[model samples]
Target: LADDGSRLWLNYDLIKDAKQRESYAPFTKFIAVASDNQTLKIATEELQTGLLGLLGKKIVTVKTATTSGGIILNVNKNAPSSANISNEGYEIYTEKGNIIISSKSETGVLYGAFELLRAIQTGKSLAKLSITSSPKVKIRMLNHWDNANGTVERGYAGSSMWKWNELPHRVDPRYVLYARANASIGINATSINNVNASSRFLTAEYLEKIKAVADVLRPYGIKVFISVNFRSPRTLGGLKTSDPLDPEVRKWWNDKTKEIHQYIPDFGGYLVKANSEGEPGPQDYGRTHADGANMLAEAMRPFSGIVIWRAFVYNADPNGDRFKEGYAQFKPLDGTFDPKVIVQVKNGPIDFMPREPFHPMFGAFPKTTLGMEFQITQEYLGQSTHLTYLAPMFKECLDTDTYAKGQGSTVAKVIDGSLYNAQYSLMAGVANTGSDVNWCGHPFNQSNWYAFGRLAWDHTLSSEQIASEWIRMTLTQAKPTEQKISDMMLKSHPIYVSYTYPLGTSHMMGESHHYGPEPWLAKSARPDWTSVYYHRADSVGLGFDRTGKLSNALQLYSPEVQQKWGNPEQCPLDYLLWFHHVPWSKKLSTGRSLWDELCERYYDGVVQVGNLQKTWESLKADVDPEIFENVKGRLKIQEKEALWWRDACVLYFGEYSKMPIPKPLTPPQ
Candidate 1:
């Protein structure tokens, strides 16, 4: 009952308002469920638990829908289907004074049950509830960058949630809680390890451990997927070469796939990160990406499994633009991939920066099933220290007009199979979850996870709406508090971006850890890894010239997209620096010189963090003391880091520009 954030958004704490409780009590008189499936059982139990907590009364469970004026869960064979609603979709309507949840499958009933509980927790009117909903994408998944040794790669929320040391014998209750949290938000599949995978996970020893985790998640309609090291044949089975064309290598993977199925029959196949960041792949054997992916796809095809091959591959080419690497590598292999293989591409062409144009690969691959991969973890967006609700960022990418099919071809349509008519569709988020007591480290960080799941379920949902729903369910039902929190969540991303990488000047953070500002870093193991490689700051100007002159990266996009972002004078100010290198004294559309504008943005960004701190301080009396203080402390750290970023970048860049900081702007201390 303590507000340690361990409950996440499933916090079905008793409603303190008397009138609200009275209003919900009528529907909690009795619960009737007709299905006997494990999923339905969990649904029934969840509804019962939620009703008891919210309405302060225990509801009786009935075998039939004989009892009226209570919640009824039934699987209807004919449910008046629509294009928007699939077999997994549910219809919840109030029929004859009884709330009826009708669906074609038991999984639909479970999702409906969670939706009903969400409506209650958010204090929505259940009197005339008529909601028919289905997921926009087929496979909504979470990619955890957690290693087997309990150390997460880009993870900031303590250690890995899947404790490898305590496996099949000791099942942690936390694992079940994690499933419940993900299930509540309609997340169906999860890749349990980092894409930079370990070969040990393929062995019999680790299969048992994975099976234990899968058993806990199965009841919640969530399947476990593993990130497989491509050279598992050589590393684990002692093969001479892990070539896709080699019969011995193919047989090794076939046996391994069969062995994996033996432990967990419903395992969602492998997520591979090959030939990127030093990962071994088919390229090492003079084969294409399709060769590597098809080999795994064929092995998993018999079992109805899929191979999610990551398209985040890039070379250490000093002259090559990192933004163009993915498009160049994957464009030719558009139709070459097997039917079961879905190419997982990051939302941005480069790594997950604070801001980026939508990846050109989104609409380019007309024949391939292109899945959108978003990083829910704050890898480049200030990690867990800064409070950045990424729904707005995610929506920006999803809503961008790729112009692939002339007028209104958005990225969402492409991934949802509406644009390209692909056979399979998936949207994955690099998970921010860990072994932290609060799940995500920061209290506000929980909102990013909630937002990712909500947006993945329905890309059309607005960021403000998602933020409001999360605030009401997790923090407070108070209207004023809800509005304040929602406003903060909406503005946090832009504010963080302003101080750090304003106007699309990305990858300015520290080289290795990617922590603070380091625009001066010119040397690293690889050219693309350094900050100077991206900013391209010289005595004349700053920003990478990705237009026609330098890399011609903009040429990869459709002509319509190129026309929109090509011109420096007409381009959106937010993306100005991303495409063109402007002189320090050149005037922008904002009527200020480039140097003055940059300084103002950096200084103003720090001020915005101060404003956020003030807004949060006003909620001290309204929020839970523990959670409130946790966020309060993080805001202080955010302010300090925001200042650190402002000072580091402005001073460093100013050194190259030879321009004085504008007098109106407060110079960094």
Candidate 2:
């Protein structure tokens, strides 16, 4: 195997363990599928191909299932006993010496096929296999910040996966493979263009191109979505004013949406990033976010479409706490949005820092359908060089108790529609994929994409379980290798966090690129974009005070959450700096002074990176040489950058805290 990672986790390499292969070979006699739907055809072919590759046995395809040993895939529309399973959910079990996969729809049958293959590839026994699963979130989607000019904003992998010039005439075969990869993980939708959006995509020439991409993905049960420019009525249709209330503007949108449906009938509606980051929206005409979202939702309502309106807006006020901006802007507009509209909120209040408290909007909007937006692309984490598995980061936010309904009201429950009883629910990841040969730049980065899909399907899954499963299916089958890689993945996020922004410190990266450390950055286009605006380091103390005395941002959360994070003495150390400004001499829960604790974390972080390198190096013989070397090289860069961040922050923050670096700490070189 070349190990280029172009195959992603779909690598159906032959099983090397003879005993394990022999045990699974008996069930590889044939594949039985009754339906001739395109999705089912793909599923049937995938199973046949995977079995032949994994077991070295060609399985015959039959029209209907038989009693003998084999795999049976069926769409059971009226299985009253299995009513618990949803339309997109499936049940797989062994019956009469054969494997049976049953679901209510063809898409569910396809998902079960992939699940069956995953179990076999991961060395799970199929002798008495029984499993039933369904997606927790209604819409598991990917938001690609890819643009019409073939550039990806905040993307580290490469240029856009979409080739704008060649589409509609020359479709890339990779598009079909991309659909397969997404379908395998239960991701059902993707917004194909950048949210910053270009009006050119609305032109007739480009809609045809988009239709080409959608055609390839439709068979895999993945619907295509587009990010629409709010000013498209004026920019593309030559309208006078692009106000949501204006009849002309509304008619323009309605006609355009109808035109779009003609080409791509199953088109999933618009993703609008309006009135934020200089993007035009209804706000330019003095209208609210609900006004903007409802307008677009109405346009697509006839076609069963939706509008995913982003809530990532904030004013660049020098005195304002960015943490409070999202909640303040949207809380008052609850229940105003149309039923087809969903408010897309980011995972954290601040831009995707290495660590931050969950956004307060999760449980606040009881009347609005809230969708979670997690950055799968490592924009603030370390881009493409450092390997940081984000499952733990996402899990931390999802599992946090919002205390909205007294207790156990988790952010996961809110976004999955179990908390608010909302009509629609969604979970979206800012895609890390690009034109890179490996899809995501680093091979291990692919794990983050896999983790997002798995967690989206079932939020209850532990980060360790997802890591172990990915390691077994993609990297190695050896138990020791699986354990080692899983351990590395489990620890990678915290290690990166410690060295970069320990104790909830955030927005300390370089201004525009957001690549490396720049704690000394005092000036930028906006005060909120500067490092000083976040840390607020001064002669007497460090950290921004979000308590009632200062910004009063702590009041946004319920009393239960406020009590947990309001007091510096009781707040989790990981979130201390986010809420309080502690003196250099103040002792923390860890028994170390504030200054000493910061130094310890930075030093410990670099040491952990070294250990990760050692661990990966030790697995050279057990893993593919290409992958081992690729990760090894990236770890070296990570170590160097970790030292850079440690040195920069310790020396810079020390100027304000007026404390010496701890005696045992080695100052960054």
Where is model 1 poorest over a 10-residue stretch in terms of lDDT? 660-669
| Per-residue lDDT value at 377 in model 2 | 98
Flag regions of model 2 displaced more than 4 Å: 81-83, 666-669
- Residue-wise lDDT of candidate 2 within 330-394, one digit each (tens)? 99999899999999999999999899899999999999999999999999999999989999999
Q: Cα lDDT of all candidates, in order?
A: 0.91, 0.92
What TM-score goes with each of the models? 0.98, 0.99
Tens digits of lDDT, candidate 1, 1-669? 449999999888888899998897667777888758898899999998888777778888888867568999888868677786888889899987789988888888889999999999999989999999998988999999999899999998999999899998899999988998888888999999999999988989999999999999998989999999999999999999999999999999999999999999998999999999999999999999999999999899779779999999888988989999999999999999999999999999999999999999989999899999999999998788899999999999999999999878999999988898888899999999999999899988899899988988899999998998899889998999989988888999999999999887989788789898888888899998988889888888888899999998999899999999999888898888889998888899989998899989999999999989999999999999999889999999999999899999999998988999898785433
The parts of candidate 1 lying over 4 Å away from their true place are 77-81, 666-669
Q: Please report, as a residue range, the 10-residue window in candidate 2 with the lowest summed lDDT.
A: 660-669
lDDT for position 318 in model 1 = 89
Q: Residue 377, candidate 2: how far off, in angstroms? A: 0.2
User: What global local distance difference test value does model 1 have?
Assistant: 0.91
Pairs that collide in candidate 2 are none
